[model samples]
Target: MIIALTATTQLGGIAWLIGRPFRQSLLVSLASYAVLSISAIWVAPAFGRTPLSCVPEKGGAHAGIIFCVTNRHYVTPELKSALNDIVDDLNTSFPGIQLGVLDASFPFLNDFPMLPHLSHNDGRKADLAFFYKDSDGRPLPGGTLRSPIGYFAYETGRSACPATRFDLHWDLNWLQRVWSKHELDIDRTSKLIEAATANPRIRKVFLEPHLQKRLDVNHPKVRFQGCYAARHDDHIHLQL
Candidate 1:
């Protein structure tokens, strides 16, 4: 339980320990985790990190509540500001756009591993979901993602990366049929990349080569993450 909790949420294992000796372990542990997670919003800033809002804000929001519940929505102040700025920019042309923030670093530790994204150990990296339009050719309300957690719903595209047994390049072919029938909103996505690349604070944006061509994203800062890392066609990775 501790291992799984720690793997999912960095602070969950410690919360488990805090509730281990109690009579109602499940309730105690859950309550403990809630307290710890909420406390992180205040405590994390001391360590130079800020927690992204779990609720849908004016400009941005966690792609799903799962990210906040798992304690995976913390980022540096500069990054948070940059994301807000990008979303604010998007709203000017595309009104009421709520940028979906996917996996981000945990609060507190530097060089502490966030599984699947080892480089996200620091608070400088975050994943943003691609904007999607409903099958009817209309933008989904508030930029809703095709997948529940803003991941694994890949757009059809070709890649140069070869098959590897040890890497994180999971196709998850079986799950593709289960997602919502939403088409990638190419205009919004292209604009998002342009805005992100234009931002001087964002040093790099990792995306697949095919997507760059498909979306007409040609900025030097927008580069491929390579075969060793997970595919970025499903989401965008921005780092300082």
Candidate 2:
């Protein structure tokens, strides 16, 4: 009876989270943590949980040949749809190119779990690695930190603005923490950002303001969130 009651409570909490606004999910997340501490009924989180629902089977790579990075792999249905359609569009814009998903969707039933991110609580955002190219300037293939060894970074002392210095000296601390490589192909990166902004479904893009100026991304949807988080010099974050 006790175990059954706990499971029922967990299910109800999850249902409340899914039906309510995103902001309200924080309460459910906190409650889940508390329950996990006390109840033998608690189980490890489901891999396929999104803000909408926890479908353990729907998480991860799914039917598509999409490459996902890290545990932040729970993909939302809407994001999945957009990605499937945009793959060909990105390929057409830059031939021989594929995408690297840094983060997407969220873990099952825990919208407010303790994560490094601030807004990834719901299944509405995705972060992608910048398109890379070889030294010869040809579009390169997508790779993880291990497979192809894509390493790129910025040197310090560059002037992004007169008042403030740029976040240079490519620090691998974040990458090391997440086990991601910093191999960004700058030229193609810019083009990829441009191509991404062309999609109407991609609501907004977060990039370095100066980098935006350098790329000349005149799209209204492209925005610079300042250097509060690391500069957008390394990856492109897309919101749908």
Candidate 3:
């Protein structure tokens, strides 16, 4: 329980430890986790981090519920501002579309290495799910993520990197078969990338090479994250 809770929510292991001696351990642990998580949201800003919205805002980007529940949605205030600005730009071009965020930095630490993502240790980094469209090319409703947690539903394409093991670049072939039949919205996704790269505060954006070619994104800051990192084909990684 400690390992599972710690891996998902950084604070949950501590809560479980605090509640373990109680008669109703599960309930105590859950309540402890809730209090800690809510407190983190308020306390994090003191350490120069702020949380993205857990729930979707009108015409704005928000992290998926999975990210929120796992306490992975904290980011620097400037990065949060840049995200809102990017959404504003997107709304100007394609009104009413909202972006879905995946994993992000945990609250209350610098360089604490958010697992699976090496660089997200700092609060400046975050992942954004690609906008998707139905088979007919119409935009899906806002907040509709291709995968439940907004990761691992890849847009199949050719890659230069060879297959390997013992790294973060996972090819979850079995899981892909079960995801919804949604197509990547090239126009909106491309625009989102453009907005991110164009933002002065956003230092870099990681995307797969094939995706860059397919989207026709030529921004200098949009670079490949290298094969050692988790595949960027599933979600766009942006950092300050």
Task: Name the weakest run of 10 consecutive residues (lDDT summed) in model 1.
Answer: 55-64
* Count of residue pairs whose backbone atoms collide, per candidate: 0, 2, 0
lDDT string, candidate 1, 147-212, tens digits: 887888888888758876788887777899999888999998899988899888999999999899
**Model 1: lDDT to the true structure:** 0.86
Best by TM-score: 3
Candidates' C-alpha lDDT? 0.86, 0.50, 0.87
**Models ranked on TM-score:** 3, 1, 2
Return the lDDT, model 1, position 59.
58
User: What does candidate 3 score in Cα RMSD to the true structure?
Assistant: 1.2
Q: What is the lDDT of residue 141 in candidate 2?
A: 57
TM-score of 3: 0.96
Q: Candidate 3's residue-wise lDDT over 112-152, tens digit each?
A: 75676778887899998888889898888556777787778
Residue 217, model 2, lDDT: 76
How large is the C-alpha RMSD of every model relative to the true structure? 1.4, 11.0, 1.2
lDDT for 9 in candidate 1 is: 90
Candidate 3 pairs with clashing backbones: none
Residue pairs in collision within model 2: 49-108, 150-183
Per lDDT, the best of the predicted structures is 3
78-184 in candidate 2: lDDT tens per residue?
76666555666655655555556655543445464423345565656776665555556555555332223222342222324333334432345445444333344
